[model samples]
Every structure is written in C-alpha cells, then in structure tokens.
Target chain A: METYIFYGIAIIALLVSFQKNRAKTRSALKKAWKSFENILPQLLTMVLLIGTLLVFADTALISKIVGKDSGWLGVLLAALIGSVTMIPPFVAFPTAAMLLRAGAGYMQIGAFVSTLMMVGVVTMPVEIQYFGKKLTFLRNLLAFVFSFAVAWVIQGVVG
Target chain B: MKKGKMILKRYRFALITMAAVGVLLLLQPQIGMKAIQNSTFQLQQMFFVIPPIFLLLGLLDVWVPKTTMVKYMGEGSGIKGILLSFLIGSAAAGPLYGAFPVAAVFMKKGIKFSNLMIFIGAWSTMKIPMFLFEMGSLGVKFALTRLAVDIPGILMIANTLQKMLTAKEVEEIYQKAETLLD
Candidate 1:
C-alpha cells in the first residue's frame, strides 16, 4: 500500500521532469553527463569498498562498538562507521532493522541512518573535486555534527 | 612514457580504492559475500533503472530553461520554491547518490545553490518509500518525527551553506563549468 503511494509519486515526478523546456533541460543533461563521466571511476571504487566492508567487517564487533549499552561512544562509533560506509537509504533502513533486532539501540540506529544519508566520506574525493575541498569539508562536517543532534533528538522523543 | 604516466595518474585513485576493497574482502570473505548477496538485487535494479531515468532527467534539464527552475525554486525564492524543490526531490525515488548527477546538472544551469542543496538533502533524507518502511517497523509517530526534523534541517543547512560560500568561489566554479562545457 505504501509502496504504491511512493511509486505514484515517482511516476508523477518523472512526468514533471519531462515537460516542455528544451534548452535548459539540454544544458542540464550535458552537465549531468559531464558530472557522471567525471565521477564514474570514483563511484565504482566506492561501490567496491562498500561491498568489501559489507563482506569483511565483523557485525559482532560493530554491534559491540555501537550496541545499545555503549551510550555516546556507540553513537559516535555508529556515525563514524556510517560516514565511511555508503548505503542507499533503502538499504540502510533494513540494515538498521537487522541491527536493532540484533540489539542495537534507537540512538545508534538514528545516528547510523542520519550519517549514512548525509555524510559521504567514501565519496569525498569525487565530492571535493566537484564542490571544492573547503565547501565540501564544511558541508560534510556540518552534516556529521547534525546527525548526532538528530540521534539525540530521536532518543529524547522516542525513549 | 608520458602517455603511460598520464594513464597511471588518471587511475591512481581508483587503483588505491580497489586495493583497499580487496584488502577488506580478504579480511572477511564470509561477510563480504553476505553483503554482496544482500544488496545484489537492489544494485542490479539500480543499474537497470538509473541510466534511463538519468537520460530523461538530463533531457528535461537541457530542454527546460533556467528561468523555469529560478521561477520555481530560486533563493529567498520564498517558501513556494522550497516546497516545490522538496516535493520534486522527495517524489523522485531512488538512492541518494542518484540525485547527485541531477543536482550537479541543476547547479550548472543556474539554480540557486541553496535550493540545489535542499533538493539533494531532501532527496536523501525525505524518501517516501523509506518513510513508509519506517512507519511499518518503527510506527507512525517515529516516521513523522523524522520527516518533521528532516524538512527543516535540510532548509537550514542549505541556507547556512549558501551564506558561507563566497561570490568569488561561485564565480570560479561557474567559469570552470563554462570551460568544461565548451
């Protein structure tokens, strides 16, 4: 049911993105292609790293580092892990769910999700090339700090 | 020799990154296999879906004039533009990285940098499917709180970053982009 709603929204967005506007859309496409071409190597590398992390990292060790009882230490560790590990938002949720089932806390999960979505340590090289180092660094730093705030807020509200 | 050097330099980062991945895989073969298995279907789906969508997005971006984006989503562009960009981004479903290419295109075409940040932020943070999934697992209130926090947070971050970035830097990027395009 919810999935249907999302699909409906996506279809509408796709349609809207297609409407009349030839010149600007063409320029945007060119830019998109340029960005895509530039980032292709970095993207592939990041994907491989993520795959490797998923395969090799010990979940038990991760859980211990950020598990329910570890408090702020856990949150920090979770955020750090999330910064380096890039997962699609969709995948992050289920992975968080599995972690929660395995005894991770709300704070840990919140930090993980927020950082996973916002901070891009893995993609930093590509991001820096495109946006410049200072701006990219500042944006990522702000996002990382903000993720902790988000986690705390979630903890207060839910717990 | 120069060509070889250029090739080596071009691939240096990729080679290092691959080596890092190989080391990680070697350290945990079982875990690596599980991660690959877990994400295989989704990754395959993404590979299939993204190119076509990006092509269309590219086509639209090129076809649509800058004025349209500005008119719809400019800075201090007011709440309407913000809302529209948010809605558009949220509605465009897929991985957060999927928005990167599109956002880069929008930035090149003179969309306000703040608005592009908002779009990308919302694209990653305010996903519709993920919201529903959260609602199922975590409850409606939990999902709603996340949405509430994310919307304002995205706006604030974008606005703050816009102020921090100088006009000179913006001009430099614009010039560089123009040269690249040419």
Candidate 2:
C-alpha cells in the first residue's frame, strides 16, 4: 500500500518534470540512481546483520529473555535487542503482543518497541554516511536512554 | 582491475559479512539458511519501497528551490518550520534509514538543525499509519500514552542535540550535505 503511493507520486513527479524540461527530468533520474547506489553497500551489510540478529533473537527467545518477572534488567535487555534489530512495525507490534502474552511485562515490551523504532545500531553505517559519526551516535545514544522513559510511562499507564 | 579493487574496498563490510554467512552455512546449515531467507525478505522489502523514494527525492532536489525550503524550514522559520517538519516526517512511510536521505536533501535546502532533528524524531516514532497499527495491536491506552509522551520527548531531545553540537560542527554537517546530494 505504501509502496504504491510512493510509486504513484514518483511517476507523476517524473512525468511533470519531463513535461517541464527533459534534461532536468533526466538529471533527477540520475540523482535518484546515484543516491541509491551510494548507500547500497551499507544497506547490504545491514540487511545481512539484521538477518543474523533476528534469527538468534527470534520471538520465542525474546519472550523468554524478557519475561514478566524480569524487571528492569529485562527492560535493558529488550532495549539492547531492539536497538540492534530492525523489524518493521507490521511485524514489531504483533510480535510485541505475542511477547506480552508470553509473559513479557509492559515495561520491557515498551522499551523494546521504543528502541526498535528510534535507535538503529544496524543502520548506523548508513546514517553515519549522511550525518557523520558524532550526530548519528549522539542521536542513537539519546534515544536509547529515552526508551527507558518510554518504558516507564507505558508501564504506569498500561500495566 | 583498479575499478574492481575500488568496488571491493567500498563493499568490504558486505563481503566480510557474506563470508561470515558462508562459514555459518558450512558449520550450521539450518541457522545459516534461515538467515539467508531473512536477508532476502528484507532485501525484497527494500526494493519495493526504496526506488520510488529515491526518485521522489531526486525530483524534489531538482524542483524545490533552496529559498523556498529555507523560507519554510530554515532558521527563523520558527514554529511554522517545526510544524512542517513534524508533518512531513510523520506522513512518511518507510523505516528510519529512508528518512536520512530525505534529511540530507533538507540540510542541502537550508533547513534548521533543530527542525531537522525534530523531523527525524517524528519520522522515527510518530508515523500516523504506524500509530493506527499500534492502537489496534497494543491497545489504545498504550498507543495514546506513547504518543503523548513522545511529542514532548522528541522536542526536548531535538533541542538538546541541536545545542550539543558546536556551531562549527553544525556548519560542517551542512557542508557535508552539499557534497552528498551533488
């Protein structure tokens, strides 16, 4: 669904740009390809890393690691796993619910979900390519800490 | 041969990981095959979503004027800039890495640093469709509470990050952006 919308807009934009100026349209296409190629190496590496991490940290293992009685330590572990693994929301939420059913506490699940969305240890290479090292690390570190706050708030409200 | 060497240097990390996977395949076939499947699935998702995004980014670079971007999102664009950043970021439809290229374009077009961070924050967590999914899957209380906490949290984080960088560092980032797109 989201892919379609992106394609729709991109094609329309290309057509409009072509109508306006053929040369400019061609440059846009070139720029698009260049940018995509620029990050391909890092992206390939990230995809493989995510694959390995996901296999080891599969749902069953994750649930067992962050079970309900695990407390703050579980939240830390959950945040660490979330930071390293890059799961899409479509998979992440349902997995979170499953973990909850499997006895993961709200705080741990909250930390997991928050870090999963915000911090990206796997995507760091690509991010550093764009923003440089300092900003990228700073942002992720801050987000890692902030996930704890998110965990606590969710626990208070939902648990 | 020289070109091949350059390509090898550029893709060293990927090659190393591939070799690791190969070793894993030899030693632990089941886990290795599952990893390969997982990587294939991720690669498929990337191909589906990434092409059009890069295309749109290209069009945006060619079409949108720096002056216009600055007027709306630069320093002194103030609250309006912040709001626009949040809107654009929240309306986006990919993983966080997708946001970085868009952000590079934003920096090239002279968006304020804090607003750029805000945009990233929103892109990271406040996505509307994702929010709907969260509500349905995690319960309304969890979803709403996360949303409520996240808005202020994003602002605070963005502000702090913006302040943490030296003026020289921020300028260097913008200079880097100039090279990234061109």
Candidate 3:
C-alpha cells in the first residue's frame, strides 16, 4: 500500500544519505525526531479530542441525522458532523456507503465526506501550533464553506 | 527534574484533557469506554503514518537546499511549482494535520505561500489512495465529481488566502516556521 511505498522511499533515501555522509544522515534522523517530539504533545491531545468527538458522531447517529429527504437540514448536519469529527477516510468511506444504504442522501454524504477531508475542528490546536492562528482559522473556515459546493456538485453529477 | 517539568508544562493541556476524559468515564461509562477505544484507534493510525513522514521531512530538510525548493516552488516558480505542489500533496498518505508540519518545513525552505497552500489542499482532498477508496465506496462518479470540483476550489482557496494575508503576515509565518525548525 502507500505505507509500503513511503517506507521504501525513506529507507532507500536513508541508505543513500548514509553512504554519502553518515553525519548528515544522522542529523536528518535527529531533526526528524526533534520535530516529531515537538509536536507530540499537541498531536496526542488532538487524537483524544477526535476520539471523544467520534464517540458522539458514531455512524448510526450520523445516518439518523442526515437521513434521506432531509434536504438542506441533512446537508447542514452532515457538514457539521464532518467538520467536528476526525475519522480516517478508510473507515469513513465504507461508513458513508453504509449510511447511503441506510437511507442517507448523497448530498449529505457529499458534504460529510468533503468536510471530513478538508476541515479539522478537533485538530485546530495542532494546526495552530504549526500554521499560526490566523492562517489556520482562515484555512479551515474556507474549507468548511467550500465543502457545500462539493456537496452540490456531487449531488448534481452523481446523486 | 527540570526537563520533566518542561515536558509536563508542554503537556498541560493533554493532562487536563485526559483528566476530563477520566471524569467522563466516571460520569458516563458507556460513552467513555467507546471514546477510549476510538482514541486508541486514532493512535494506531497516527503511529502508522507519522514516523515515515517525519523521517522524509528530516531528510528533505538536510538534503534539499532552500534554493532548490525556491527554484521550483517559490515565488514566480509558476506552473511547475503548482504542479509539483499538487503532486507532493496528492501522493501524501497522512491526515491533513500531518500536512501542516510539512508545510512548515516548506515555509522554512522558502516555498511560495500559494504553492504551500496547494500542497495542503492536495493533502486534504485530492490524495490518490483516498480517491481510489472514495471511488470504491461512493462510486466512481461521485469520487470523480468531487475531484473535479476540488481542483479549482483548491486553487481558488490558495490564491484567495494568499491575497488575504499581507506581506508582513506571510513573512512572520515564515519566521515562525524557521524558529520552529530550529
């Protein structure tokens, strides 16, 4: 999978760098660990927040919220759920399929999926740690708003 | 002892949150248990994706010169920068939050702000593996439709944000990134 490819590239690059200059390779590893450790505290907290949020936004509740024929209400609920929650896309798509089967509208699912990818309410603190408050806020706000367009387009083309 | 204190200071928010979660467990056992499971699940994903990214980022930091990044993705790097930004982002494998650190590194390396935003956009929505999965779960038509809409939206967002942030703001962000890497 993609993980395998990333591991392969990283190992190969590490080997090449080692052969070229051991010190440089060592420094690279150190730098990597430092940066990761610097963010670890925030990252851990974000994961916990996502966990709590996901518990409330579980699939059954989501399907209920965005039921078919719910129209804009469903889209709004879906977008709000997607914005707040942080489910992995791998799990999310299958769950989306299940929601669709359970009578959720495509427009709602579209909003949910798009916002799920683009907006990260729970991860805002970690984002702010790296991106600064202004840019992070602006970026997520923009993504959240644009997700409705994504929903509309998908509904038009596929739903 | 000092380092331990520093670590605790840095992790104060996490500690408070964990304490709150414990309180939730006492108050609502069912939801609390589920939340714990969900948190562990997220932790699993984070471990799988985070290490290699930081490793690659580290390598990128040491090996790639700022000049090289600028030549390709900096101001006036133009269409090539845009394409490269998209490719780097689309090929990525982690959550959008993961992209922020990479974006920080990009800023340190002098990548153009717009290209950096494009990279973030690509990471957020156009990820290739995620796209394939979306196709499988949501149908190819829905997946493709989102991708088509997203491409333009990504560009518009990056440009709009670029316009919104003043030159001083952008410089300050880059400076913040530089210090962060150090």
Candidate 4:
C-alpha cells in the first residue's frame, strides 16, 4: 500500500546515500531522529486526543449529528466535527459515502469531507510547535470558515 | 534530575492527556478499551509510515544544499516556485501531520513563506491518490467538485496567510525552524 512506497523510496535512498558517503548519510539519519524527537511530545498528545475524540464522535454519532432533516444546522455540525477530528481521507471518504447512503444530506457530507481534509483541531499542538500559537490558530480558523464556503459550493453544484 | 525535569516539562500536556484517558478507563471501561485499541492502531500506522518519511527527510536534508532549494522555491522562484509547491503537495501521501516536519525542513532550507503555505495547502487538500480515492467513494461529481473549488481555495488561503503574517513573525518562525534541527 502507501506504506510500502514510502519504505521503498527510503531504503533506496539510504542505500544510495550510504554508497556515496557513509559519514554524511549517518548524519542525515541523526538529524532526522533529532527533529522526530523534537516533535514526539506533541505527536503523542495528538494521538491520545484523536483516540478519545474518535470514540466519542464515532460514525453512529456522526450520522445522528448530521441527519438529512437537519438542514444548515446539520451542515454546521458536520463541519465542526470534521474540523475537530483528523480522520485520514481514506476512512473519511468511505464513512462519508456510508453516511450519504444512510440518510445524511449531501450538504452535510460535503461540509464534513471538506473540513476533514482542510482542518485539524487534534493536531493543533503539533502545528503550534512549528507555526506558533497565533498563526496556527489563524490557519485552522480560516480553514474552518472556508469549509463552509466549500460546503456551500458543493451543495449548490452537486447536492 | 534537571534533565528529567526538562523532559517532564516538555511532555506535561501529553502526560495529562494520558491521565485523562486513564480516568476515562476507570469511569467507562468499554469506551476506554475502544480508545486504547484505537490509539494502538494509530501508533502502528505511525511506525509504519513515519520512520521511512523521517529517513528520507534526513537524506534530503544532508544531500540537498540550501542554495539549490532556495533557487527553486525561494524568494525569486516566482510562478515556477508556486507550481512546484502545488505539485509537491499534491503528489504527497500520508497524513497532514507528516507535512509539518517536511515543511520545517523546507523552511530550514529557505523556501519562500508563500510557497511553503502552498505546499501545505496542497498536501492537505489536493493529494492525487486521495483525490482518486475520493472519486471512488464519493462519486466523481462530489470529488471533482471539491477539487475544482479547492484548487482556487488553497491558493487564496496560502497567500492570505502569507500576507497576514508580520515580517518579524515570519522571521521568528524561520529562526525556530533553524533551532529545530539542532
């Protein structure tokens, strides 16, 4: 899958780099580990938050929150949840499809999918580490608001 | 002892979050069990993809000179820089979190702030494999519509964010990136 491609390229690069210069390649790996360690604390925090959030906002909860009859309120709720949780698109798109089949409105799903891709409340700490507090908050806030725009467009054109 | 305290300070929020998870377990075993299972699953996914990513990143960091990255994606890289940003972002795989470390490297290597934002925007939204996957799961109409809207949306968002930052704030971020390496 996607995992294999990353490994394949990484291994190939490592071999080639190793062939070129043993010392330089070793330093590269060392620097990689340093940055990974720098981010490790925030990364661990994000994983736990995502776990708890997922349990609370399970697919059933998502369906209930964004039912077909809910209108704009449902779209807002869907966008909010999508912004808050960081589901990978692979699971998210399929879940969205299932929700569509199970009586969720297309507008709601549109908002959900858009925000799910564009925003990440759970990963805010990690983002903050890189971008700082004000910028991180602004970025997510803009992306959150923009999801509604995306939802509105999708609803107008497709739904 | 001082070193331990520094580690603890850095990890305090994560520790508290784990403690909260433990409290949830005590209060509600079933849901908590599911949460732990979910965390482990996520951890497995992380180990699977993250190592190779960091490794490749490490190699890039060592091998690619800053002048080259700057020439291609830096201050005067222009429309070509923007296009390269979008291309790299769209072609990327893995979660959005993966992009941050790579982005940190880009910053360290002196990529323009706007282009870096473009890379981030593209990585978050227009990833090609995920786009194709979206088509299968959500239908061409929905997936294509999102992409069509997102292409413009991503550019606007990236540019706006770039413009919004004060010069000092941007410099501070670049400085932080430099420190992140050591």
TM-score (chain A only) for the predictions, listed in order = 0.63, 0.61, 0.61, 0.60
lDDT of 1 by residue, B1-182 (tens): 99889767766776886676556558877665565554453345445434444454454444444345545675567778777788767656556656766666666676677777788788777855456656545556666777888887888888888788898886675555455444
* Residue pairs clashing, model 3: none
**TM, every model:** 0.63, 0.65, 0.65, 0.64
Report the lDDT tens digits of candidate 2 across residue range A1-159.
645766887799889899999999999899878867777887788778767867777766655678766789999999999999877775577567656755678999999999999999999999998889999999999999999999999999998
Task: List candidate 3 segments past 4 Å from native.
Answer: A1-64, B1-70
Name the candidate, 1 or 3, with the larger DockQ value.
Answer: 3
- Candidate 1, A1-159: lDDT as tens digits: 443454455456555654755455556567656645554555455545454554445566556777667799999989998999866654465556556655677888888888888898888876765567877788888889888888888878864
> Is 1 or 2 the stronger prediction by lDDT?
2
Give lDDT: candidate 4, residue B177: 79
Lowest lDDT sum, 10 consecutive residues, model 4 chain A, at A90-99
What stretches of model 2 exceed 4 Å from their correct place?
Answer: A1-64, B1-70
Q: Write the per-residue lDDT of candidate 4 for residues A63-155, one digit (tens) a residue.
A: 677866677899999999898886667557655765675567788888889889889999999999998998898888888888888888888
Instruction: Give the per-residue Cα lDDT of candidate 1 at B95.
Output: 60
Per model, kept true contacts as a fraction are 0.39, 0.81, 0.77, 0.75
Choose the strongest candidate by lDDT: 2
Model 3, docking class: acceptable
Highest-scoring model, DockQ: 2
Candidate 4 lDDT tens digits, B57-158: 677768865344445998889999998888788766668988998888899888999899889889998987577557656788898889888888888888
lDDT (0 to 1) per candidate: 0.67, 0.84, 0.83, 0.81
